[model samples]
Target chain A: MLGPHAPVATPEQLAAAREAREAYRGGLVAPTSGVAHGLVQANLIAVPRDWAFETLLFAQRNPKSCPVLEVVEPSADGRVEPRLAPGADLRTDIPAYRVWRDGELVEEVADATAAWAEQPLVAFLIGCSFTFEAGLADAGIPIRHQELGTNVPMYRTARQCEPAGRLSGELVVSMRPIPADRVADAVAISGRFPAVHGAPVHIGDPGSLGIADLGAPDFGDAPEVREGEVPVFWACGVTPQAAIMASRPPFAITHAPGHMMVLDVPDAAYAA
Target chain B: MLGPHAPVATPEQLAAAREAREAYRGGLVAPTSGVAHGLVQANLIAVPRDWAFETLLFAQRNPKSCPVLEVVEPSADGRVEPRLAPGADLRTDIPAYRVWRDGELVEEVADATAAWAEQPLVAFLIGCSFTFEAGLADAGIPIRHQELGTNVPMYRTARQCEPAGRLSGELVVSMRPIPADRVADAVAISGRFPAVHGAPVHIGDPGSLGIADLGAPDFGDAPEVREGEVPVFWACGVTPQAAIMASRPPFAITHAPGHMMVLDVPDAAYAA
Candidate 1:
């Protein structure tokens, strides 16, 4: 309903997001990779009104993994538009939406309005690593998963996120194996963007985070570990979803894996 | 009763704080200057347990001025210190304490143990600019107020802080006039330390922030504004103090102006 659908493989970022948004409005379900080049993409979560404050505090305390972009305060008034995407509807902007009841996946819908119809929901747009990944790539650092055309490997680590009231769970991290030489460059580049998940939380040994097996990821596709490459783990936005599942919030909504909300902010806005 | 008294201006930071703490514990009323020469000193606020969350969120949202060092959750069990200072009692560490009730300063006491005695109090240690000031001085930037031997001039501005539930008020800023040539260095030096007030919220044109008179200040001693030197305003820790007064919380405790809790953390821990 916004742009066009099924963007060309190498479409420009905004054009691609607009096209993808258009496709999504027309009931198209697809991942938003390479859609909006140089723009910040975000993970979306919608939860009951009562759980909003605790969730906000949880993200605030553990900002690396769950940097809040826009929090639409929960209200009985319903469906307040966020300023992140102008003229875009939160319920219909993303390619696909997942509805979870009592933390279990109940349905996948193109539009969330139907399931979220009467419920008082607070929507949170969380910073995604896609923007920083663009920075890493711009710096000439290789993104192993991108190179392999697979989802970035994510793991549920032993590192517990700071509990905010009732919301508490283990931190989740997405691993990006970098050539040994580019590790410092990667950290320095990403460290500047605290609004997004900044810098690698853990580098080299996965064992330090209690990540038992690198090949066996809890979420997303595992990437090939190259010679001379070390696995760097950055806090992942999916952390809240895992926390929600563990905390069991009764009802919730999230973007399908890899299906993010494309914001108007350029990825470079987050660069130092 | 921890350290000593009147550290010979150049005593080691830890030794200096120890001396100052000893003097305060011995009921010697004095300002805590040159006490912890290179250590981070904090602004302390102890409020009721029910108001702790809102206060934490207020500080989280208005971080530049209210960068939290550690929040000791209010428990009926009494003062539980953070690792900021081991064996340092929150009740007796600072030189002086201010007690507020129903938004009015009720007493300025030698010790808060009596006023904050038995109630469940949540103590918040907020970052102070002294750490960043150390960095600026390191870069050869002149600290006008420090040189003049006075409290930094603070002003209440028209800028509204992001409110958390009941805690909301106008922003308060501390002004330091930087020589035109060194303003950039001052910003660069301070920006690295976000834990303390980082960078100038307003650099030039005091009118832009709705301050009509440079000579008149809301709090602290007024400094002579030099010609050709730009007045740089940084968010002040006094902001939460003003907010507490405005919000009229049942009871609150704060460090008497310039009398801060000398933390064990060296000033460099805050450096970027």
Candidate 2:
């Protein structure tokens, strides 16, 4: 469904999304940004049923960082089909997947069918900031990372998340430099899409969140904070992956950074 | 943490809330409506760890009816302290508790210490309409049930909720008679608190929702539709209870209707 603020996808945009998903399912590995316009791209995380409760609870407790779009419980036959996309098999659809063993990244694979078949895994499709980034760009706010052709800067803050069961970790945030005058506008635009990481958690000072230096981030490329710009920080989706590492679940799977699962659902579907 | 729209609670109101909670813990049995002027009250549901994931997933899928405020995982000693109220025991804080066995209401108890200790129970504190009702009253919208001194009329609708695991049930809604002129005001006021059941689900016709008689309802009292007034329906918190009955978990616990767990957090804490 299209939202009032989001334009309806053109036929070409729809075809691009469908083709991209087909290519990924066919074992093509590549970054997904800018591949499909006006469609929602999701971060994928799958864990065994034994750890699903804790993972789901952790997301519930820290919704700002983990905005779950859908949770796909394996069927009696142990097949997972995310509701966001019909007839799409999660096992092999994402562009790339990271396999973790005891919280350590063991390998990266283009397809995860074999790993998925090993256990009854519950898959979570979490909202990504790409949806709201479109909203921000539409409102004339400059996204520094996009202009620089680099990854968004992410930092691990000193703020401890509300722990759920055994899963606990520090809050992680992604930073974007917005013009001083457009900071409020950027917040209002992104806040409309709460299902994605909504609104800036911190506006002006990174040090306040225990981020020692904005230039040296824990993940992603350094940001370009031009003159007359303020570094605005939004809760990062990496927070859940950080929890998986901190809590050290026996096994887990996630999409490699920048390699996302494109959904059939429109970006506007997540807008408030 | 006072919200801009919400007024700060006076000393007497704060005292009244504290006293009401203490009285309930000391064996007083009464409805909790109007007991606390500006504090938040919550709906309680405690199910064994076996059924927790399904229940939590059900709430996530059907958020409008079952907005979860906090989930309390039992400690090693089997003690549950809801984060909403520090140092408060869920087993004895509420005015009344209902014990369910295989989806059937087996007994109503004043203190649930025995029932709670029967097994490891994970307690979920869900949002209640009482929080938004304060907003409605503040906006000068009349709440008919309050004037009639009867429970809000609730009905089982034809719409089925999105099933989660073993949980599946029809959507249940509460009805309030609002003057046609102020229906917009009522919706706007309540929509501000999404943590509770937010805006009206239906506005004018009962037949459209598959309700045959306004005089009869599946739960709560029949309504008084005055002249120039329309029946407005909202997703009811009773939905989760209906799902519990439909799905028939082996054992469950809930607060008696209209008897709630009072929390220390201000109502504004939940305001958007």
Candidate 3:
């Protein structure tokens, strides 16, 4: 893989994403920003088999924010199947994993074999925007946060996701300001990738979603909206984190923000 | 409301669905097939609050077969508020309810108050094809089973639903034979109503979905396929019943196949 933070790779490099997964599994502990440009990048969430039912429901109920690509059940021999990666190890494919206990993040580790080995755990690979952003870029629309070299601005919206079981929380959204002329193109492009967070949930007026300040966000840096550009918000994968904080399960794991798991599938596989 | 086996109501009659709800509350116990022509019809599934998490997950995991319109948690005063109906008492809104204990159907009753009163129960209102069938009829597509005045033929498929907790079973699909020329129109019509078992899961061959015979089905009666027609299958709401049987949950409640809860919202409201 190219040096960390290199611009998004070419189609050929993305098709050969096993190298990126190799970099992660072989102890490269950096955020997976641009490792495999045209492949799926997943946000990770792991919970014990006992808690797996509700957590999976949490993602399923809020599909916009948590479109699950595949769930590796602890009972299924816990093998990392090819829906994402053919030979990937669910316990260590990501660059980093965060361990949360009782709603508090307690540890960030390069691998989670220790936690996973003790008890059967279900690993959920939720769709993230890396593939859709690649689609957006290919469609000639620029991604603001990537160009700025910062995390996508995310905010907790007033919109409530349909509650399922013990998991319920406000929908969290990531913002990208596209030129007014390109907003339709942006929607058309992103809408095709529903497995990733699809079309803009809200297109205008921050207050409508209860986001107080465009300059201040609940997570990530402020977005840079250009003149004649509109802020387009898509459901963010970080929603599971907010849900975790609210539901307060005893044990959980997630990928550190921006440190995603690079999957082996081509991004085109996710396009609707 | 009309008697059992009444003709499908006119649009104006559907607009007055509250009268149907009243008939149900006033001890008129009959299947609700023709009660409200243009309103939404839902399948009911109730489990204790402790089992709700897993049951909800099962629906979320198998959305095509079990589209949940609303979930009334026992913790929330447990009164049903249909997104489609206001001031509806879920306990009596449906004409008939089936009680299952240890995976066996033990009783069919008009009122579940006696069972529901003793313990907190979470009721799940699942999407059914009443609205989509209306769309199909409007599009000039034939609904073979409905035309024959029989239940839609349902079969156990080889494709297993993504298991959630203790709920795992082969997907159950309802079959309809649309004229070969109109299959596209059938899909286009049903695709608009995502809330009501959107679109066909499989088309053309019953064997593709693991149905051994078109003349024989595991649950519903066999379907009659006309010349120049193709068998189209949509995920059936009976899926949860199969899951409950497979998982063997201690107690559960479901609507009898032909009995449904009529909601107040217009069918058009569910169109995408």
Candidate 4:
């Protein structure tokens, strides 16, 4: 529910976040970065109650793919009494959402209220890179997307996640090419934080992870690999989404790729 | 079972493991640590199929207390289809066992084949410190118990675990007093390995964890705190067991504390 012609600046994004919760009522901001400085952003997933246990099991089985920040399932009154933000409506917090039916993309909507009923829809919010990006920047590790003003490139890898009941898919990774000498530094910096995606799952050699070409990606934009750099891969939060979509649940809702739910919790809370 | 005169030496301990498994045909080398050099060790919990999910959730919610290494509830036999060391019998792997009924201790025996019924009894092999103790020694971190020739001191702290379905209790911690200068390095080293109870849960003052006196522990021997040392605490495996005991399931089986099942998997498998 981002307003047409609303500025896309970080302040605008923050304003959009407030407006979505305050003025627009369940509206979403365009992009979640810049808007909520130093706050934690999360990738959201809403599934039917019947699949809650399976999804949670899948997350547990494949933690690197889905580092769950929190799992919420509201009672009939639509309030997640204990483990949720005040008035935090899962249906409207994020800027955008994707609806899946039987493993197919059915709709991209702002609100999932119509699709949600008394069936006890479970909501899971996963950790995002927005938190780590701030740390990397402070440590002088430049994030390519911010430099190019584009989205980070994501790839489907041969890495297979530990399967758990109807959730199975190839691992997905986001590529951030770092200078060869700085790879150790990057690992040391990111390694300190595991609540968000921890140290690189794969340090070098894209082919070892079944990535064929650096010029192409299954999602997001292509990376600009420098001469002295190697493509470092970190487990992406999308792996669970891919697994759910592949499993083709009867009903599932996820935040649109890259558009996350901004929470009041600080980024430091996510650090293990 | 160990002989009354069993040396209690590492090799003698391993021979005991082999004998226990040999008693059961196609059995394991009696659950593997102290049997083979650098073999992985595990704590076992066997629950009826009906209670599998709840127990697994308990482990998941209280990870430090019940750090699961692997789950083996084979679909066919309703027994733990041993993986790291197949043909191992959960019912008789460890030298000693405990059976709980409706949240109370029912019996302490050497084997539970009599308790085994046709239905599946899900088994969880959780990681034990015996794995990390080797690493700690390899890193030259002096373990007090090794010197004192006694069991590690364990205390039930005021720290409560995140609860899940009929499972929740105050965290039980194993204390290891370390020199003040080595505390930070010890944390760094242990932090690298999350599977083995990760890093120290409480670093400085034990009082913060509601531990009033170091000389007295709820379980195990009292610590002899040396000068220039601070008592460091690691999340103990007893945490989940305590919670399960409080929850009082209809029936449960656990390896007698300290008598772990040795797996064929190497200790390195525990590292991140």
Candidate 5:
């Protein structure tokens, strides 16, 4: 967690984040794990103007899994821009895009400008766990997925999220194996940053959350749980996507899994 | 703050809360400060359906002052019920209601059923600062208003809340005087319950927040500041009303200041 006097974002970090977005806008597609160091990265989800209320209510109801960083309402002229990253087009700044029609993945594209233009889109920028990874590392707690150089393992639990209007789905959680004794430290550190997925939702026993196997996940890469380590689960940003899949909005757009939009704000800006 | 194992609400507390609601429903009009001890109390704001989206977005944007506990959407056939207290009629269960027309307070009534029938209303149950006073008292921090048996002082500040579509206003804050040495302790205690206007927005020197005089507040009672005490201000639940006053919608309803809905849930349910 950042101290009270920490600067939100340094001038150098701001320039680097903008450069990364420019590169993505030019057709670079990849996971954005370490793209813009010290800056915040967000999960993207955009829906039609009519469905925007339910979507916003869903995030407000399930804040643990879907902490909204910013909401960019569709403009009168059909223009959209996230305040988190001013001047960066929401349609093309992300590394990759996933277009959904009737809750199914219709296409994966390098740019979503055409899909976004189909109708007025209300875009939501949601907080990603990547914003709090540095805090855990600073506390001497290891992040298993970062060490293995893979996407964090995620699973869809039996737990049903609070239904909001026409949107409802199971909770999706990302897992990280922590040394047995350091689990408390990990919870304490991450709990300080509620804006970014906060504390672990489940500390052990995946079966309690209805996950059958540790090596097999519903989304992302598999985990490597070693001896003396316990699997800890934090609410994942994929929850909103899970809701989109279940609720089946007629038209929707989101970032391809693990591909995020880098924001100009610093990670400390999200620290509680 | 409650421990992990604390029960949400005792059976006795639930019964007391229900009885209090029944009394209010039977035309007993009064403030709900100590009516049902250990139960949560909330500020009420109901708006027409057309303005619900903008109102919800405003709350989402200004979470500190408008931490929404529950949103009771109008049901088919125009029925309204708040899930916070089952079997409770939102329009008639509250002790008092304020009828607003074009940003003006037209009347204060004991029951709002007649006014509610005029339009489909979406009611918002917002967190109240009374929810955290116990925590402060438990930490040995004095709450000035409680000692003097007066309403907590509230003020409209120079700080502008992040605006949403068609809804905007200056932030309103509730003030409580704390001993100079215990200011930090008060902050740490209240900060635990983010759902209920967490932490102080300003510590001392009310002029910094554009208040010309501390005693003459925009709302609520005049505070009694004693020797060795500093005034601490927190985001007040009345902020949404401030927005209703600033951005006058066609129609609106709210609980009269200091008269709140006593919910069946325990105060611990809101603890972070």
Candidate 6:
């Protein structure tokens, strides 16, 4: 999960990710990421059409974290357009998936073809932290997840996202340790990309966000806070997914954490 | 209808207008310009609660003209709260009102109180053109309606508003002929206040908006195209009203054209 890739490995890795997904359809590679490169990855949220507008409104109100990329319309015949990727079935495109029943994820899935239906459900594509980490590195900012060779650290905060209809919940944010001098630069760099989680919500104190300890993140790996550094927090896209879990409609689907749907749009488009 | 107060009226005239509305619950003081200086005036629309979200989304999608100032929650006792003024009822608040049935104007009433009910419905307060025209004069931009003592010219355009759900229509704009040299200054002046129709949508060429003649507008009076002056169009708040007329819900209520609910908030708040 951690290591710099060869210059050619970027493309090679993306190819391998696609190949893995293909083999995933045939039962090969069991996880995504560590494989894709140059391709824009996305968080996936699938819900019935009846609740599409409320969910969409939730994304709009909590834009910093839940910046939507594309909304794939389910075809009249109950199939996600092959546009997510050619010859790809949403039910089987990723290495892993999670199925939620009445708001609680009941089972992890390898494929959901049997679950695909004629119901007018919608699929939403959201930008992810991985997309921003690429930009941070380009700006000479260090990312903690890459350093630890583990998942990025995320926590539920005291901050609540703007509520819309039935969609409401506390915000979840991801943290990265930043050098004291580079904090401003990191903020300025990320602020330019409003489509992604633009800028830091909190810069210095984890307690200010009701986060008890830096050592205990609600999700992913714990980060090392250096002597002269501070932990910076950015609104995490997972906030909406969490809200969906709480609002639990009859049926909903999301990518299993790290696995993402690579898109035709480039990361550059995510920039403001 | 045309008098010295046509451009500027005293508070007494506005009070009389309000009193007249309370008397028989009716009055029509054409071109509400200068009528209620400090009182909140509102564009009115009444529709069954079932279609509330579509209309709200329509207004949100077309913010330039339909800048909602407030929303009246659906009542359980058939009474609207936060009434625009004392003894002011949504049923009979405004001086003049138009009623639409199945997308057609069925009646023009002096009061609509008879239709009042605990039925679910939502109301919104949109920014009015009067708010911006006042700011323009403060900035030294003499508006034509004030000088010529006439209503502002409003026209329907070829440009379509972004559609939401059941709402869709071409934009309607108010045209003001400004001194040619002052167009840029006028834009910079008005652009600072986006809440009140913001900047002009087009600077010249009425034909571009699908208007066949400048002498005749779909609404309001035409202006003389003075020498060295150009027609400047601003998004009118009427666009939402027009959309409502097109997609007429079974039941809806709106303020008469010029009779508005004067809000406690000042016009200056509309300034960006």
Task: Please provide, for model 3 over A150-216, each residue's C-alpha lDDT reduced to its tens digit, 9 standing for 90 to 100.
Answer: 7778898888776666777788898889999999999999898877887888898989999889889
Better of 1 and 5 by TM-score: 5
Error of 5 at B166 (Å): 0.5
Give native contacts recovered, as a fraction, per prediction: 0.00, 0.27, 0.14, 0.00, 0.09, 0.00
Q: Write model 6 residue lDDT over A88-202, tens digit each, in one string.
A: 6677776677777788888777786665553556777776766666677877787766766777788888877777667788888989899999999988887866666778888
- DockQ, candidate 4, comes to 0.11
Rank candidates by DockQ, best first. 2, 5, 3, 1, 4, 6
lDDT by residue (tens digit), candidate 4, A1-272: 11123223345444544554553233634555444565667778878866775676677666766777777667767754224234567777677778888889888877667666535677788877776777788778888877887777888898777776677888889889998888999888777667677888888889989999978987678889989998999888878778876788888888877677776555665565
- What are the clashing pairs of model 4? A14-A35, A28-A95, A103-A248, B14-B35, B31-B261, B31-B262, B32-B262, B33-B262, B103-B248
lDDT of 6 by residue, B4-85 (tens): 1113334574565466555545454455654445333557676675575566556655666776555565456666654334
What's each prediction's TM-score? 0.83, 0.93, 0.84, 0.79, 0.92, 0.71
Best by DockQ: 2
lDDT to native, each model:
0.78, 0.83, 0.77, 0.70, 0.86, 0.67
The docking quality of candidate 3, as DockQ, is 0.17
State which candidate has the highest lDDT.
5
- Interface RMSD, model 5, angstroms: 5.2
Q: Over all chains combined, what TM-score does candidate 6 have?
A: 0.71
lDDT of 5 by residue, A64-137 (tens): 89888888875666567777777888888999999999999999999998999898888888888877777788
Residue B227 accuracy (lDDT) in model 5: 99
Deviation in Å, model 3, residue B98 alpha carbon: 2.6
Best candidate, TM-score-wise? Answer: 2
Model 6 chain A is weakest, by summed lDDT over 10 consecutive residues, at: A1-10
Q: What DockQ does each listed candidate score?
A: 0.13, 0.42, 0.17, 0.11, 0.33, 0.07
Candidate 1 at B12: error in angstroms? 4.9
Off by over 4 Å in 2: A1-11, A76-79, B1-11, B76-78
Candidate 1: lDDT over CA atoms?
0.78
Give the per-residue Cα lDDT of candidate 1 at A43: 89
Writing each residue's lDDT as its tens digit, candidate 2 over B1-272 gives 12234445567766777788789989998777666866888888999898899888988998888888888877777667876666778989899999999999999999999998888888888888877787787788888888777777888888788888898898888888899999999998888887888887789899999889988988778889999999999887778888888989999999987788888777777777
For candidate 1, write residues B58-105 as lDDT tens digits: 876677788877766534556656566766778876878899998899
